[model samples]
Target chain A: DTAVSQTPKYLVTQMGNDKSIKCEQNLGHDTMYWYKQDSKKFLKIMFSYNNKELIINETVPNRFSPKSPDKAHLNLHINSLELGDSAVYFCASSQRGGGSGNTIYFGEGSWLTVV
Target chain B: SQQGEEDPQALSIQEGENATMNCSYKTSINNLQWYRQNSGRGLVHLILIRSNEREKHSGRLRVTLDTSKKSSSLLITASRAADTASYFCATGSNNDMRFGAGTRLTVKP
Candidate 1:
C-alpha cells in the first residue's frame, strides 16, 4: 500500500482556471507538506501543516492555497492558474516537524500543466 | 530563494563504479537529507545527517555534512544501472525545508 498518495497525477488547465490536487497519507504522520518542483528541477516548499494546523507557508502566491481537513489529508487549490504555475507538485509527510533525523516520505507527484 | 545548490549539475558513471555529488547551502540547518527521484517518479529518502553529525551511511549510500562549510555530499558506492536518477539535497530549518536543483546521475550499464 502507498504510504502517501496524491490524485490528479496529471493536470492540464488553461490560464486563469482553477484546479485542486488532493493528497492523503496512511502513515500516521503528524506533519504534511506541499513541495513544487519546477522545470529546472528545483524543489521548493509551498506549505506545511502539522496535525491539520497550518505551520509553514512560503512566499507562494495568493492564488495557491493549502487545506488540511484532518491530520491525514492535505489538499492544494490553485485559483487563476498561470503558465508559470505548471510544475510537478509533491505531497509529503513526516512523523514530526523539522528536526534531526525525521525522514519525510513523498507522494508520486502531481504534474500540473497550465497553458 | 533556494538555500542549497548542487555542483556539477549532471554526472555519468559506469556500473560498478562510485558516484559522488556535492551540495552547498547558504544558511544553517538542523539536518541535511539526500533523496533520489527516478525519472518522472516521486523522491525517495536516501540518508540524513544531523547538524552535529559528520557522516552517515545506508545500504549503498553515504552522506556527509559539514555545517561549518554549509555543504554536504552524497556518495553511492558500486553504482548500478538502476541507480540512475536525480539526487537532491534538502536542508531542514526550524521554519521549513529547502531542496537543491538536484544532480542528474546516469549509470551506464
Candidate 2:
C-alpha cells in the first residue's frame, strides 16, 4: 500500500564494487524520478522517467544507469562505485510528466556508503 | 543545475510558536512544493503552490509563492513538538523536481 518504496534502506560497499537499488511505486503514477542527497543535504535530481520512457537524465556519471522494466519500478545500478557515491538516494513519483500542481511522493531513501 | 536552495539551514522553535522557512530558485518553475521528512522516514508532501497561485493552505501549513522573486516561504502556525522535522522546498520543471538542502526545524516542548 506504500506510494513509493525503495529497497535496502542502508547499503555499504567497497570501492570499485557494484550495487543496485530497487524502487517501486504503487500509486499508478506516470512519472518517476531518482534523486541524490549528499551529506550536506543538497538534494539533486539524477534521472527521470515518464511511463517507463527515459526523460530527464541529469549530469550524472555514465557509470550509473537507471533501468525501468515497467512504469511501476525504477532501479538504479552503479558501476565502479567510488567513495563519492556515498549518498542518500531517493525514489519519487508523480501523476504526470510535468508539474501542474501535481505533488511528487518520495521513498524512505536508500543510504549508500562506498568505503 | 536548477537547484532550489533553502535558506536558514536549521531552525529551532518552541511549542505554541510559529516557524517560517524560505526557499529561492534560479530558474522558472511550473510549480513549487513543500515536503516534510520525519527523521529516518520518507518525505511527505505538505503543499504545492502553482505559478498562478499566490498562496495555499493545508491545516496548520501555509505556503506562499512569488514567482516574480523566484522564491517561496512556508509558514507553520501553532507549532508543536510533533513539527520537529526537516522541511524542504522543491520546484518542478518538466519531469524533474529539484529539492533544496532542507531546513531542519527543532520544536522544543
Candidate 3:
C-alpha cells in the first residue's frame, strides 16, 4: 500500500486559473506537510499540519492555501495561479512533528506546470 | 531561506566508485537527514544522524554529523547506476524542518 498518495500527478493550467491538489496518507501519522520543489530542485516547506492543526506556515504567498480536513488528508489549493508557481508539489507525512527522530514519507509528487 | 545547503551541486561517478555529498546548515539542529529523489519522483528518506551522534551507517550508506562545524556528509559506497539521483540534506529543529537544494548524482554504468 502506498503510505502517502497525491492526486493529479500532472497538472497544466493557464495564468489566473485556480487549481487544487489533494493528498492523503495512510501511515496514521500525526504530521503532514506540503513542499514545493522548483526547477533548481530546491525543496521548500510551504505548510505543515499536525493532527489537523496548522503548525508551520512558511513565507508562502496567500495564493497558496493548505487545508487539512482530518489527520489523514491535507489538500493544497492555489488561487489565481501565476507562472512562478510552476513546480513539483510533494505531500509528506511523519509519525509526529519536530522531526524528533521521525522519518518523513513522501508521495509520488504532483507536477504542476503553469503556462 | 533554506537552512541547509549542499555542496558540489552535482557529482558524476562510475558504477563501482563512491559518491560523497556534503551539507552545511546555518543553525543548530536536533538531527540531520539525507534523502534521495529520482528523476521526476518524490524524495525518499535515506538516513538520519542525531546531534549527539558523530557517524552512522546503513548498508552502503554512511552518514556523519559534526555539530561544531554545523555540517554533515553522506557517503555511498559502490554506487550503481540505479543510485543516480539527487541527494538532499534536511535540518530539523524544534518545530521546523528545512531541506537543501540537493546534489545531483550520476552514476554511469
Candidate 4:
C-alpha cells in the first residue's frame, strides 16, 4: 500500500484562482506536514498538524490554509494563487514521539503552477 | 527560514567513485537526518543520527555527525548511476524539523 498519497499531482491555474490539494497517509502517524519546494530545490515547512491539531504554523501567507480532517489526512487550500506560489508541495507524515528519530514519509508531491 | 546549508551544491562523479556531501546547521538539534529525492519523485528517508552518536552506516551509505562543529557529512561509496539524486539534510528538535537546500548528485556510468 502507498504510505502517503496526495491528489492533484499536477495543477496549473491562472492568478487569482483558488485550488486545493488533498493528502492521505495510511502510516497511522500522528504528525502531518505541508512543505513547499522552491525552484532551487529548497524545502521549507509551511505547516504541521499533530493529531489533526495545528502545531506549527510558519510565516506562510494567509492565502494558504491547511485543513486536517483526521490524523490520516491533511489538505492545503491556496486562494488567490500568485506566480510566486509556483512550486512543488509535498505532504509528509511521521509518528510523533521519541525525539528526532521519527522518520518522515513523504507523498509524491503536487506540482503547482500559477500564471 | 532554512536552518541548514549543504555544501557543494552540485556534484558529478563517475560510477564506483565516492560522493560526499556536507551539511552545517545553526543552533542545537536533537538529531539530524539524511534524505534522498530522485528527479520528480518524493523524498526518501536514508538515515538518522542523534546528536550523541558520531557515525552510522547503512549499506554503502555512511553518515557522520559532529555536534561540536554543528555539521554532518554523508558519504556514498561505490556510487552507481542509480544513486544519482538530490540529498538533503534535516535537523530537528522534538517536534520541528527543517531541511537544507540539498546537494544534487549525478553519478555517471
Q: Could you say which candidate leads in DockQ?
A: 2
Q: Measured against the native two-chain assembly using Cα atoms, what DockQ does each of the candidate structures obtain, in the order listed?
A: 0.70, 0.75, 0.73, 0.68
Q: State residue B1's C-alpha deviation in candidate 2, in Å.
A: 0.6
Worst 10 residues of 1 chain B by lDDT: B90-99
Encode model 3's per-residue lDDT on A10-114: one tens digit a residue: 999999999999999999999999999999999999998999999899989999999999999999999999999999999999988646878898999999999
- The DockQ value obtained for model 4 is 0.68
The CA lDDT of each predicted structure is 0.90, 0.90, 0.93, 0.92
Predicted candidate 4 versus true structure: per-residue lDDT over A26-55, tens digit per residue: 999999999999999999999988899998
- Report candidate 4's interface RMSD in Å: 1.8
Ranking by DockQ: 2, 3, 1, 4
Q: Per model, state how many residue pairs clash.
A: 0, 0, 0, 0
The C-alpha stretches of model 4 lying farther than 4 A from their native spots are A97-99
Model 3, position B106, has a per-residue lDDT of 99
lDDT of 4: 0.92
Q: How far in Å is the alpha carbon of A28 misplaced in model 2?
A: 1.1
Tens-place lDDT digits, model 4, residues B4-102: 889889999999999999999998888889999999999999999988899999999999999999999999999999999999998866557889889
Quote model 1's iRMS.
1.6
Candidate 1: tens digits of C-alpha lDDT, residues A64-90: 999999999999999999999999999
